[model samples]
Target: MVENPLETETLARLYLAQGHPEKALPIFEKLLSREPDRLSIRESLARCRDEVSRAGREAAVNEKKRLRILERMLARLTGSTPPEEEIPAAPAIQPPRPGAVERRLAVLKQMLQRLERSR
Candidate 1:
């Protein structure tokens, strides 16, 4: 039976070499906290953190693109308006007041009487 190796530094380096930087991140971070003077470990931790951030940004962009594609496909399947066809928000309009409505009716009646007199 082979005993499993449990060296934290070795395991961290192994994770880095295996392109699993995210997995190595916390290990290096803890190791750095313990050995703050270790420049190599600090650099490794920084690199891992940068890689993780870049990956997160790339994933977010990919998710946005995937959602856009899915939205277009759903619009096509359901015969709904596409994103590009989305209408601008309508402007707010106040309802006509009773006095304003009555004023307009009176003006229209005056115009009608003038039209009849002209005829």
Candidate 2:
């Protein structure tokens, strides 16, 4: 059965709204391929691609942050300091609270020590 273009476009938009651009990407691509002159479809395709790219960059940044946190925790456990270059600088717009890093490190160290004792 032939699918209605309007229905397909609506489905694609729903996927985009639900934060699943990956799913919407193919649908938009299909719509655009069938209706290359349709400006709305073309715009939706561009938006979907941009969303996918943005999500990828965000995931990479989050992964880096998680790795840095883990490295810091490991360094604390081993009584060694992580290299200065490995530490990320605080965002300029929102300065970190004084002693915040130290407090967090201390709490992490206590938790690690307790975990070691439990083992």
Candidate 3:
């Protein structure tokens, strides 16, 4: 039955003050959506998002670096190739006829000239 918006804002602020930023974020965002011009509420919400994103990004970077360093150290200590997918050997190639390669090259050059003239 509270008629005052400030009272609701105060309660949301209390939640934030208690280190329950996640709990407070939705309330603040809802109120801000109802009154989008409230700069103070918008700023608080932005701060919360920025902190969360920075923490997430830093954790991702640390994890990536840890894996990279471990891979390098493992390669160095073993002095052996790390487990890798085997590349299937290509089938042996027969030498092409002299005119065959020349014809392909000529066709490619003609295509290039046509592309250049179009541009």
Candidate 4:
């Protein structure tokens, strides 16, 4: 059985289009090895390598952020302060509507008065 090079190339391009550069990288590598002079193959291989590198850097940043959060939680449990470093800023919180707390308290007071009258 013979493997078609054109089919392999198409499969590699498909993987690249689907954002699976890691999967496409080795396929492009193999294709380049078979035909080293093909400029398209060389360009695809380089693109795959760049995508893989960018992914690695992003993963590292995310891992660091996760570790920092874990460390902060551990510090709170142990009654110690975490060292000040590059902590990612928390998401912005929206303030409650005007008079929201007063309205809730008024409702609770009305309920209490009704209960008292019934007793």
What is the number of residue pairs that collide in model 2?
0
Write the residue-wise lDDT of candidate 1 on 1-119 in tens digits: 44334638889889988988888988897788779999999888888898889889999989978888899999999999878744569999999986999999999999999999999
- TM-scores of the models, in the order given: 0.62, 0.64, 0.41, 0.65
Per-residue lDDT of 1-119 in model 3, one digit per residue for the tens?
44456546778778777866666777778778778999998988887666567767988989977786787789879896654543669999999987999999999999999999999
lDDT of 3: 0.78
lDDT of 2 by residue, 2-119 (tens): 7666649999999999999999999898888889999999999999999999999999999988888888889989999874555567777966799999999999999999999999
Q: Which residue pairs overlap in candidate 1's backbone?
A: none
In model 1, the Cα lDDT at residue 88 comes to 65
The sequence of per-residue lDDT tens digits that candidate 4 reaches over residues 1-119 is: 57556648889999999999998998898889889999999999999999999999999999988998899999999999986787569999988889998999999999999999999
Regions of model 4 farther than 4 Å from truth: 1-7, 87-119
Pairs of residues at least 3 apart in sequence or in different chains that clash in candidate 3 = none
User: Each candidate: how many clashes?
Assistant: 0, 0, 0, 0
Q: On a 0 to 100 scale, what is the lDDT of residue 96 in model 1?
A: 94
**Residue 53 alpha-carbon offset, candidate 2, angstroms:** 0.7
Best by lDDT: 4
